[model samples]
Target chain A: MITKLAYKNILGNGWRSLINIFILSLVLTGMIWMQGLYDGWSRIARRQMQEWEFAGGHYAHQDYDKYDSFSLDKSFAAVPPKLQDLIDTGDAVPILYSAGIIYPHGRLTPVVIKGIPAEQNILRIPTTHLRIQDPDTQILPVLIGRQMAKSINVVKGDILTMRWKEVNGAYNAYDIQIVQIMDTPVPSTDMGQIWIDYDKLNEVKALKNSCSVIVLKNQAASTYVGSPWNFVSIDQSMKGVDAMIQTKRVGGYVFFVLLLFLAMIAVFDAQMLAVFKRRKEIGTLIALGMTKRQIIGLFTMEGTMYMLLGSVLTATLGLPLFFYFGFQGFPIPQQMSDFNIAGASEPIRCYYSPIMILSTFMIVMAVTVFASWLPSSKIARMKATYALLGKV
Target chain B: MRKLLILTLLISVSVGMVFAITAEDILMNIDKNMTAKTTWSSSRMIISTRRATRTLSSVNYSKGNDISYSEYTAPAKEKGTKMLKMKDNLWLYDPSTDRVIQISGNMLKQSVMGSDLSYEDFMDDLELLESYTAILDNDITYDNRKCYKLILTAKTSGLSYFKRILYVDKERMIPLYQELYAKSGIKLKTMKLSDVRKVGNRWYPMHIVFKDELKAGSGTTIINDDIEFNISIPDYYFSKAILKK
Candidate 1:
């Protein structure tokens, strides 16, 4: 009977009811949109990290330390026979790295030389550029990232002199031709990096059958335990990305609360007006036979119905916007390419899950009902005789 | 017969005493021929890399072993570049930037003018015998000249090269070849001197080659075109004001 009365009053209010529903719907839509974008951003970053930087995971030499560059000189050893078989079968790729100095246009710049197989599909680096069939000239083909090329002021076809220490600590230098400038989202791979063929780099460094790290296609296929090598897991390697996403999600919650506050304020104001301006209606209900508790219950139910309708309204408007953006992702700004943000080099697409949508709807509805119940509870303390005279 | 045997033993003892030479004496002799109170020199430095070879001409003024100033005079791009070395410190003046940059810490390890020589190589001020203990290895012929091979081991842990093998010319007391070794026993660099000439009473090597074994290519060759020893150089020449001029 209270529900019937509440339904009649909402329909009778018309425009006033629509305004409350509209505010709730707007807040719900904004929350959903922001959540979807953040989810999409993190998803892409993880995907790119897995595809380009860490393929499944890696096994590195026991002595290899990335932070200490001096270790690069002594951090390599011959690949074990078991891992060698995986590399031979195309399930893994061996990377050899060392510190080097390059002279481009008579300026000396320090760089790290990474050697990988031209035929391996383990990492997303463009290794085909390192494959050159020039038998007459002894020029080695090398690939540098776009940032490195820009900083060094070199272009494709430019020949630069590269000097590095051999395994025996002897220094050697040779001319290298820039075959390609690679574009990668990961700055660690591109900045101050030079990629060459695995065999050619080994020959240049005078290190035969040696590799610094072995990247595997399947991280769990083989156990490299008990060996003098470290097995890095994908989760451990991509921990930075995970931490960044979690921090961003925390910031997103602040916005969610602000939107919820705005919507709650509108519902609270409407309920307060119902208690004051509809005192005559409240008095007549009490005089006729309705209890004060029943009247309060009706008002709270009315506020909750606004959220229910708002959710429906949001679905009608927001679904189309989500679908359109999901199909054609928002283009990432050009300036973002220089940012070290992992996986942010690509455009962002909105990701919507049923659980995310339903939870947002439920939280908003509960807050709206509480905002309505607060002012409606004041009616229970008013004198019925004074309310009947519309003086309360 | 007993008197004749005594006379033979005395003659053999006198001959052995005359041939005895200590490692310290050889090192002191080489140092005496190499060091001077003050010197004024004009030379050309040729640095060869895998890409190309570049030549730089400069004039240098030095007082003792601690203070020296060098100004580049050739190569249109590097013209007006000056380097001043006071003891262990090195400062470079660039005409393009109009700035003076101090080469210190890791910057000392970088190549100078894309050459195999580093800034640390230029500011080497340690006296040889003070930091190293020497031993004579053997007498050998190098570059068609009879020489004494002297092995020098660093007395302290702080020297750049832990050990050095030097071949010194017997007559001139000048080093003909030097092999520098790292603490790990790795041969790091080699220096060879040729084209000896008599300047006043002292013999000097006009052509010198410094090869860094850790780098590829032919290394750097410094040819001394004009060398004047024991010259009075003005104190203002080594000052910072002379760099811009």
Candidate 2:
């Protein structure tokens, strides 16, 4: 009976309750999405570093620091070409990064230039629905992010040009058509990013058969660093992402937490006000000898229902995107050329973790239900004589 | 006998010319100094759109000499990836292998971390006298500095970057500006080093600019804020093990 009464109360303030529900829905969805973004960033960096065979380890904080006297030419000179072969036989896949401006369609923004093998890129790269086929034409066929479409406002068929300085002091330009503007598993990759064949880049730079990183598959995968390869491991290469993900997660959490907090506050406030407005109605129930426990049960049931409905609506709208990320991943922006946090690699894909789901639900329920408790308990404390007289 | 004596005198004259310049000739005499060697230790904060990493390093070298060595402190992201240098040689220590390895060949031409110069092509400060014939092109003025524009052509057929025109300050003989050309005679890259400052007993160019003429893509300008030289630097600091250290 108390539950029915609570339901009628929520319906009486229908429009306001709906606005509150919508706000709560956004909060819940955002909380899940923020976590999603974090997982996506890590997953992409980890996988790409492994797949691309970035020369350094994925998690290790390897510093390729050049001091004041260190010249650009000498920094490249510091890491010799012979070390790659020695490290390749080990557990890591090292890749070097190059950042430059492209000139395919009238100079796109600066992009992350990933120097990697086409076949091996699958390991660390988040899965985009599009298949990027290397084209054999005067225009270099390139792999780009989905955000390339948005930033430059370009589409799939547009021909974009890429530029690089040749060793002989000439600028080399490749007028490549975008073969794929695929979705990356992570949103951060949605900018203007391009993946050129590393060998081709070397040919242009006049440095053939050499890369700068040993992106590892595991921490203990390789231990022999000479002759064939010399590099840090996968865990070693996440130097860029550790703090990055933490900060991003913190921001994401704060946004949703504050949002959810406000929604709960509003609910708690309204429910308390509703008790006073319905004081006379409560007094009548008390005079009829309705137990205090019964009244509290009614209110608790009503609060649970509201939470359930809101959660259902949020999940209904959100789960499909989650499943899509699990299956057909989203594409990143083309401009996000340097997505390798700590030199890991690009195209990190975040999958659904059961733990994340479980915790999110718990937090959402706990906040909403806990906020309803104090107000309902206050109503339970009233004396029957005062309650019937409507004076308490 | 006269001819033999004459030839002997000429040989002596050439040999003496090689070692004639003293530290006094190269230092403290010029009205404006151009470039010098410097040693530095610093930390870098790199921020991408969503990520940030800090890297620390100690570096040493002479500017005009064309080579320097740096010891890298691993970034939070790339731990166990070692970076090292000795003369022209570079090494990246791989903790996975526990071995100090040598960096060699083709990897040299790349711009270091997107810097203005190719880390591979410029290291060895190729002995100008040995690799090319340096001809005095003309005396000109650049940025109000009295300068000599020099044309350097490879003595051998296979030297990288077939020709270079350097606008060097006459007084300091520092190549203040340089234009590099390809075998096709196409202008390829331009470099300008300026903002000279004295660090220790020697004066050095505190700024460097590298622009790639060919790509029309991207370039770098290095501005050195603080500099020192010869801080009791140890030769062992240039070793491979130190790269990972």
Best candidate (score: lDDT): 1
The best candidate by DockQ is 1
Prediction 2 TM-score vs. true: 0.46
Kindly report which residue stretches of model 1 are placed more than 4 angstroms away from their true locations once superposed: A12-16, A62-74, A132-137, A389-392, B1-245
Instruction: Give each prediction's root-mean-square deviation over alpha carbons.
Output: 11.0, 13.7
lDDT of 1 at A119: 86
Q: Scoring each candidate complex against the real one, what DockQ results?
A: 0.06, 0.05
- Give i-RMS (Å) per prediction: 8.2, 8.3
lDDT of 1 at A323: 83
Worst 10 residues of 1 chain A by lDDT: A164-173
Please report, as a residue range, the 10-residue window in candidate 2 chain B with the lowest summed lDDT: B45-54
lDDT of each: 0.83, 0.58
lDDT of 2 by residue, B1-245 (tens): 99999999999999998865532332223312433343554433221111232232323434335445544344534445555555567766666677776665435545455444555544535555555666666678997898777787766654656677877766555667888765445565787878766565555666666676644434555556566654555655555446556
